[model samples]
Target: MNPLYSPTAERADNRCEYCHAPELVFNDLFKVEHIVPVSHGGSDNTDNLALACRSCNKYKADFQTGTDPDTQTTTRLFHPRQDEWSQHFRYEEEIGEVQGRTPVGRATSDRLQMNRAAQIAARRLWMQLDLFP
Candidate 1:
């Protein structure tokens, strides 16, 4: 493991930062994610680290910006270090889509592909377990 890498178990209170699923109980591997990726000149520091599930981490790899598939407009992704998740996204239970209230939110959702089918499925399961809102 990279010395700069804090264990996911420790970083996120054992939960996925994005979906809030308890990784200890989910049986899926978790990863230490850089809020700003190293490739983008992000530093390896506590403030820049977050815990993410393998799926979310992989989907978000190396992306600092995203194109809204709907509008075809390019926008910067949300910066976890500087932005609050709730400010950028809201979960819609009926549609299982993460609605973006701002450009940053929309871009982050698009870049991370946060509304992907698999994520929706997982979120549905988590909701069933009363683990998701």
Candidate 2:
């Protein structure tokens, strides 16, 4: 486990900062990920770290920005430390989907594959159990 896991997870309320997936349903602990990759000049400071699920971490990789589908322009990904989740994304209970409310949200959603089929299926189940937003 990463040295920052405990703190990062706690800061994120044991949920994925990007996808907001609760860690309680998973067998493994969430990952402590860099909001900005070291390669891109990000540091290991707590401010740059976020808790993430495997899926979001895998797709986010080293990406700092993504193309917003609406504007067709490059936009910075949602920064958990600097951006409020509700300001950018919304959970649509009916579809078990996270809807992007702004350019940053849209880009981050698409880039992280947050609406993949498996994600939607799991989200629906989580919702039914009252374990999700």
Q: Which residue runs of candidate 2 sit more than 4 Å off their true CA positions? A: none
* Per-model TM against the reference: 0.81, 0.98
RMSD of each: 2.4, 0.7
Q: Each prediction's Cα lDDT score?
A: 0.75, 0.94
lDDT (Cα, 0-100) at 89 in candidate 2: 100
Name the lDDT value of residue 32 in candidate 1.
79
Q: Lowest lDDT 10-mer window, candidate 1?
A: 2-11
Q: Model 1: per-residue lDDT, tens digit, 1-133?
A: 6464455457567776765556755665678788788998987777888888777688789887887666878888776557777887798999777778888777777777788888888788878888776
For model 2, the local distance difference test gives 0.94
In model 1, which runs have C-alpha deviations exceeding 4 angstroms? 1-11, 69-71
- Across 1-133, the per-residue lDDT of candidate 2 in tens digits comes to 8988888888899999999999999999888998999999999999999999999999999999999998899999999999999999999999999989999999999999999999999999999888898
